[model samples]
Structure formats: C-alpha cells, structure tokens
Target: MSATMEPRIQYAKTSDGVSIAYATLGEGRPIVFSPRVFGDIHLYTNVDYRPPYIGPLVERGWRVIFYDGRGTGSSQRDATGGDLNRRILDLEAVVEAVGSDRFALCGVASGGPAAIVYSVQRPERVSHLVLVNTFAHGAEYFESIPSVRVSRDLRHIAEDQWEFYTLALANALNAFSDTETARRLAATIRAGVSPRAWIAQRDALEQIDVVDTLRSIAVPTLVVHDRADTIGDFSMLASKLASRIPSARFVATDDFARAADEFMREGEAPPTKEEQLPSGTAIILFADIADSTALTEHLGDAAFRTKARELDSALRAAIREDAGTAIEGKLLGDGVLAVFASARQAIEAALSCGRAGDEAGLPLPARCWCGRPCGRWRALRQACGLRTVAIRR
Candidate 1:
C-alpha cells in the first residue's frame, strides 16, 4: 500500500538539540503546511485517505513540507517546553533547516495565529500566507461556538483520563469525516503519539491569543473560513485578521474543513473583484421600506406609488449631494430598498426622505445606519439594511 511513492523523511537538530523530524515531498516552490494543534501533518501524505487538497497541490508541482511540532509526532519534545511562542520558534528552526529563506505558509485552525506571528517576526521570509478557520485572540466571545470548549473545562476532563482525551481530541479534529475515515484517524493517533502529550498540547492552546501580533505582518495573506463554523465564526475571524494586515484578504465559505483544504492548495483564486472589500474606508447601506404590500393596500396603489416617488426623489438628492452611492429605489408592492455609502449620510438621507413624507402628511418606513473608524461601512450596512454614500468629511 505504501509502495507507490516514498517520502524522504529526515531529522534535523534545532539550536536546542531537539531532533525535529520533517518530510519534504513534491517539487516546486516550498509550501509549508502547519496543521492545527491536534492535527498530524503526515496524514496529508498518506494516500489511503489524504485530505482533499493536498494531492491536488502536489499535482500542481508545488513542493510541500510537513513536520511535527516540537511536542508531537516524530519531533523531540522540548524539555523546556512552553506555549505557542516556543512552538513558533520551533517552526523557525525547521524553516531555517529547510534552507529556504522564504516560502508560502499554510496554517490552519490554531496554528494560524502562529503563522501570522512568524510572518510578522520574519516578514522577509514569507511570500504569501493562508489562514483557514483561525482566530486572532483568545476565544473570549466564542463560548457559544460549538467547535471549541472552555479551556478550564477541557483541562478538567483531560486531567482525569488523558487517554480518553487523546481519542476524543482525534475524533474532534476529524469530526466531519465519515465513520470509516474517523475510525482511521483515531487509530492513526493512537499509534502515533501518546495520550499524555496530546493532553499537554491541548492545554497549551488555551494560552494562545495573537490579536496584537497580526498587525505587523506585511505579506500578502488570504484568510478563509466557514460561514457557519462554531469555532468563533470563521467570517468574523477572517475579517479581523484581514482588517489588521495591510495586504490581507478575506474569503468566506460554508464548508468548515473543506475551506481549509482549498486554501492550503490555493484552490481557485476567487474572481478578481470578489476577492476583496469593494473599497477601503467606505460604507455600504441598504434601506428597505417596511410593510410595503400592506401600505400599498392601505393607501391605494396610485397614492402609495406617488408617495414612493417623492421619497425616492428626496433620497436620491440627499445621497448624491453627500457623495453617497444609491441603488435605484424600487417599490416592492408598497416598500422600497435603497443603498447608501456613509452612515451619517444614509441617516441624513433617510431623515430627509422622512421630512418629505411628513410634508406630504404621511409616515415613511423605518431607518437605521452604522459607521466605522476604517470606514468599511459594510458590516453596518448589512446589519441595518441600508444603502450608503461616501461623504467627503
């Protein structure tokens, strides 16, 4: 079964004399794959059940590197073991040993924070970075997310039966796999690393929070995540990461695990315009008239339609004068949806429209808006459903 190809696995000694084991495969620009805390990098190489994107990356003629962290797999455990900082240095050691000063880095899940840290600390050594299903800080507001658990709770559970915890860790990491694949993953862990180490490693993740570390990274970065992930909402995390890194871009997906795989392989670059925020320091607004159908019936189509036209005129004038972009005000039965750029401008436009409605002795629909320091008005626009226009001030 292992005969078709053989990976040239080797051992390298870090400055601390810890023997780090790494396997280099394929041939092209180096792409180092840093798995999540509970992940086995070797699993990407095992064809019996390889990850979806790993084989594809190999087929694309990219050189891929996979190595165990200091405390896991074939790498010797750090006697003076510490948290992610120490682990990150371990990665640095490996990168130096690999003899390439710069390469593309693919970090998934918990490892993502470390990748950013490394990129910032060693900017000249990274060409591009891919962060999938990652977090920037301690998952303080992420308790409601199902993929993660409270550190104290996991610690308590691990203290009692480390072996069960190891198996559980393996199962949790591969939660989306089919029954047979999950079984194989569990077996692989049981044979690869001890229960004690797994527990220690799991405990280490509790101390990681890299929110401040991401800012210094200047390399081009891609952040991908599942739209519905319980791991603190990948979209939110991606947004945070992308916002901080000057050259970072965010990509949202519905599949939790597959998104990570696709990013590791750089699967297809999203359509050019879709790859980034439409504008920097700008806002988007959406305003929808309330109870349009009922309003139409109550006012009679002719009168309601007249009121809508008046409202549209007031909205368009206010938005354009303020440099706000507007979607055509369309009547949906008895309601209208309008978009704008600036929060204050949208609010001003809505309030002005209301004044026009009042002059006609009638109430318009509802109105709301949001603003940001960075001027990315989208989050607010989505939340309040309003169109936005950019204001010069």
Candidate 2:
C-alpha cells in the first residue's frame, strides 16, 4: 500500500450477527493482525500513526489483514469487545470473509488472548502466532499492578469524561509519554469506541482467564513484549506465556516485525505433502462429567479447575495408552476428545477415562460416548480435517 491512498474498508457479519470492519493490504501469504479492542482501522492506516513495524511486513510479501473488533471502530458498538469468546467471533468472521486456508496470526495487546484461543482451537488453520504485549489471564495481568487493577473502578470516568480517560490511558500504555503521537492516539481511541462501550468491554475483559488453555497451543509462536514496560510490567506476563507453550519463543525487541519475520523465516517448514488428517474406519471417544455446571457450583471455580485439570490429564494418558491420539482442542468443554484406530482401542480408552473420572471423585459419574464414522467421515474431513468416529461406554 502506498502512503498516498487508504486501504479499502470492508465488513463481515459474525455468526452472532455482529458486523466487523476490516482492511487488507499486500499479497502472497496471509498474516492477520488482531489489534487490541480499541483499534481504529482509519487511524491504523494513517501513515503518521500506524505502527512503523507493520509496513515492513507488507513489503516482505505478506498479505497483512487488520480489523476493528466488536464495539470498536466501524463495528457494532452495543456489544462488549474484551471477552475472549467475542474476540474469537470477531476474528472468525474476518478470517472467513478474507478466505485464507492457513495464515500467520499477529495479536497485539489485549487481543492476544483471542489469537491464542484461536490457535489452540484451530491448529490446522493457523501457520504461526505472534503475541505482543499481552497476557493469558486478565486478573493476573491487572493484579500484578495495583494501579492498573484499581483502574477498573475508575472505568466510570470513561463514560463521564472520555477525553480525559483516553488521554490518560494512551499515556499509561506508553509509559506516560507526552508526545504528539500520544495525543493522536488518545483522539483515535476516543473515536474508535464510545465511553459506555469501553466500560462494558473492560468489565468483560476482567472475566477472561485463558491461562489454562495456553498449553494446548502447538503452533510455532513468537511472544513479544518490552523489557522496560511500565504498564503493569507486562514483560513478565509475556515471558510466562512463552515459557508455558510447547512451541513458543520469547523476544524483547523494539523491531518486532523484523524479528517476527526473521523468526518465521528461520522456522518456516512448508508442508511437502497434503496435511495428514484421520480417515478410514475409526472410532472417536469422548468422556466428560455429566452436568458439570452443577459440579463447578458445588466445588467452586478454583477447586473445580484443579480437579478438572487432573482428570483431563489422566484421561489423555489413558487415551494414549490405548493407542489413541487425544484431540485436545475440540469442543470437549469439561470433557476430552480422542480418536482411535480401532473400536477396541476407542472402547478401552473410553472405559479408562470413565474409571479415571470416577477415581478422581468428581462427585458425578463421568459419561462416556464413542461411535464410528458412517463411511467417508465427511463431517470431519470437510470441516476440521480430524479423522473421528464415536464410542459409548
């Protein structure tokens, strides 16, 4: 894109009926940017304001995609933008509209959680991940800095005095810098989101806790943050995120785009053959506690999470022992997903998962279900590309 013209703005409707505004630049392999909830597409495109690092990505032959999430920019403003689920919806809508079979995902600041969640859920679609200045848990990110945590109560100020709050927020994110860029950023933020919407989004962000899901990410990831970060010392958060994921590298550099490009280039391993998807005649296994909501209410969130994690690990281990591959990222909710090469393996794994759940004393007997695919496994093949059948035990 030249400095003289703005990228064309477009829209995509989410499954839940939210319309997301987005813009794309350059061509070749795709790289979608998930900006923080407060980003403005117009402001992002402005040569004077757009992050200097992003332009080089376009120059490097990447089809860079940018979008404004719900409640911000040209998107629907009546909704909240910070919750991970809603952010996922925004990203899903944009990606489906743009039509990339597999692409690198770059998530900035608060938007990183959405990117992480997406990578975990749809490993086949995302080639790599770039997480910048973000954390997995909202509470952990905020409570580490008292002022930042306390700032939530002051969210009301956004509704009452938006101009003041946005300026203060702009400075806070920039370590209290008072540059012309900061002033412009403050104005952009104000134009991107209304005060009421910001308040709603902030409240929703506080409820997000995707730390438990981080370990499921299997894609190559680049975690970036500033060493001298002043807004809650987020570098540690970024470091912790990198350390947990099996395939993540932590880097603290000013030239993030260049670093990301170098890292991706070094790690790039294009598939020489078609992606391996499970097919033929196989059985799928699923084991989960029945009525988990009641159990969570009884055990409390903390205790329930610990028990659930333990049970999940045990079930996965059993699945592996039975010669089955655990599909950890699918729609299991409180359950676990596993695919087996045979009915005997699937049934045995299902029984073991049930036994494990019982031994874990989850208070409710775990339910087990498995079955075989009817012929071509078209549902799995066409959609997730996962080979799956089913079993009941």
Candidate 3:
C-alpha cells in the first residue's frame, strides 16, 4: 500500500482528561511513533509526508501510529501544567486506542526520553524500541552541549519576543539555513502552542532523566544517531545509551532516516522498481483559477497565458513546500494537480496555493474536496483533469 495514504485522525483522552490526537496508517504490526514536543501529528505527517524513517516500515505492511502530546497540535491545552511523568499517559492513551497488545515503538528527538521510560516500565507491551536523535537524560544533554544551554536560555524570550524566539529556536534546531523548512517549522511550533506553553514544554523536557532506567528495559532496542547533528552531540549520547542498555545496538550515521531504513531492512536486498512506486491509498488535489475564462477574455490570450504560467509556478511551489508531489499533466488547460501523503496536507497545499497566487498577482483561487476510492494511475489521471479540486483517498 502507499505510505502517503491519508490517516484518519482520532482522539484519545488521558486519565487526566487531556485529549490526545493520533493517526494510524497501513495495516499490520502496529508501530507507535512518539513525537517531539513541537511535533504535530497532522503537520509532521504532512511535512515529512513519506518520512524516510517510517515510510519503509509502512510499505512493509507495518501500521504506523502518530500522536500529539498535551498542549500541542490538535491535543488539549495544558491548563494543568506540564509534567514529565504525565507524558507517559499520553503514550498509554494512544496505545490503548490502537487496541494493540504489543507493538514496536519509535521515538524521535525529545520523544526519546518518554519512549525509554515507557519501555522500561511496560516491557511486556513494547516488542521493540527504537530511539533516534534523543538523549537519556536531558540535564546531561544540556550540560554536555553549550549551544543547547544557550538555546534553553532563549525560552525566556519566547513569550515577549515570539518571532525572534521562533527564529532563534529554529536556528538552534538546525533549520536556519533552510529558509522554507525553517518557516514551516516555525509555523508548526506556533500552531502547536502559545509562547508560554512552549516554555513549559521545554522546561519539562529539560527535566527528563531516564538514565537510571535504561538498564531496566528488556525489549530489543536500536539507538540511531546522526554524527553531525547540530542540535545535539549524538556521538556521545548514542554510545552512552548503547553501553547502558543490555544487548542494544547502536548505529552512527549522518542520515537518521537511512539508519532507520537499514535497521528495519536488516540486510535485505534493495527494493525493485515496482516496489519503489507508491500504491494502494493516497490523497490527490486538483486546483485551477476560479474564473479563468473571464480573465482570459478580458486580458487576451497572451496576457492570460503569462498570468497562467505565474499561477502555475506559485501553486507548484506551495505544493512542494507542503511536501505534496505535483503530478505532471494538463488540468483544465491552466490548473494544477498534486498528490499529498495526507488529506490535511492537500488542504493546506490548496490554501497555500491561493495565498501564493494572490501574492504573485495571479487571479487564482482554490477549493478542496476529499473522498476515498480505489484505483491506480488511470483514475488519478481522470481526476486530475477536473475543473474543481478534489481529494480522493
């Protein structure tokens, strides 16, 4: 099945009444993906789209679960304050919702610490544990890296100077140079929670210390780290974690996603050409100028063609920004057709196209519709030519 298929968003309430938002994709052995504090289930699933880490697993028939913790994304706000211990309940709620007796667990970035604690406490429930770009102890991580300390100190500025703080945090997160990615990361962070809540989440994350419990985890484990990660010194952290956990395997590479793929594939031959292309389910988007005929009549063919080219460029860029793949085909003479990993992403891309077109002075307006049908390239081709944009799952 296609890894880009739109996952149904669902809510799971924690013991404390905080609602956690989660989504599941594919069908097979369940793998719970523990997200970082700023990670949004909807946005990250769309942003990374076919994420290198999870896509291969999904393609191999593993069901992937993604959830947003309290005070972030579609989850409930943290009116009760941030508690590191309570974070475990978020995982528990998601696991319960998935109705799985045992499953593999993958944690990324800040989500690693919680995953470690959960695996240690509930060893029977977690069949395998994978941690990427994370630390066992947050305090040690900050102390080990001076830049991290400086980043933590910047949280004090988040509430008063959110824009500046977002830029600084994005830089600290190693996103400053990639302007588009940085902007999107900033938007995800902003959409997740208020500036004050960001501070609380950071503080809670900093307080995490699971070093004492590392040895207690009995499940098979893999620790992957990027040697050149600017965000954290994973070289030291990965080695320390691997040495502490009994029978744990440690891998050091520049690409966390590739490391994950290797760990999952385990010496299997590379996938063939047919296996490379996505199949099964996907979300498709089609967009065009709302009144192209009238605009063309008024502006004449030459001017209208120029405007059409500009609109197409703007729309393509927007779709790419949202990690949507724009299909190469003619749609209503001057429209755009794209496929996203998620319906939420398709909607976001359509909205982004409208904004981009407006900014570029193109008379393009976009709308979105979603549905689910089963077919392949021919169906997608037929749908792409529609005057109105529609998303089929």
Q: What is the Cα root-mean-square deviation between model 1 and the actual structure?
A: 18.8
Which candidate ranks first by lDDT, i.e. highest? 2
Q: Against the true structure, what is every candidate's RMSD?
A: 18.8, 21.1, 12.4
Could you give me the TM-score of model 3 versus the true structure? 0.64
Please give, for residues 68-125, the per-residue lDDT of candidate 2 as tens digits. 8888877777766467788898899999999998999988767788899999899999
Q: Which ten residues in a row have the lowest lDDT in candidate 1?
A: 270-279
Candidate number with the higher TM-score (1 or 2)? 2
Q: Give each model's whole-structure lDDT.
A: 0.57, 0.70, 0.69
Off by over 4 Å in 3: 1-4, 45-52, 78-80, 145-147, 227-232, 254-393
The local distance difference test score of model 3 is 0.69
Report how far off residue 311 is in candidate 2 (Å): 53
Backbone clashes, each candidate: 20, 8, 0
Instruction: List ranges where model 1 is wrong by over 4 Å.
Output: 1-5, 45-50, 77-82, 141-144, 150-152, 170-181, 226-233, 253-393
- Model 1, 171-289: lDDT tens digits are 45444333454466666665545556655665666567777777777887888764443234556656766788776777885432344335544656532222232253444433445
**Model 2: CA > 4 A from native:** 1-5, 40-42, 46-48, 145-153, 179-181, 226-233, 267-393
Candidate 2, run of 10 with poorest lDDT: 269-278
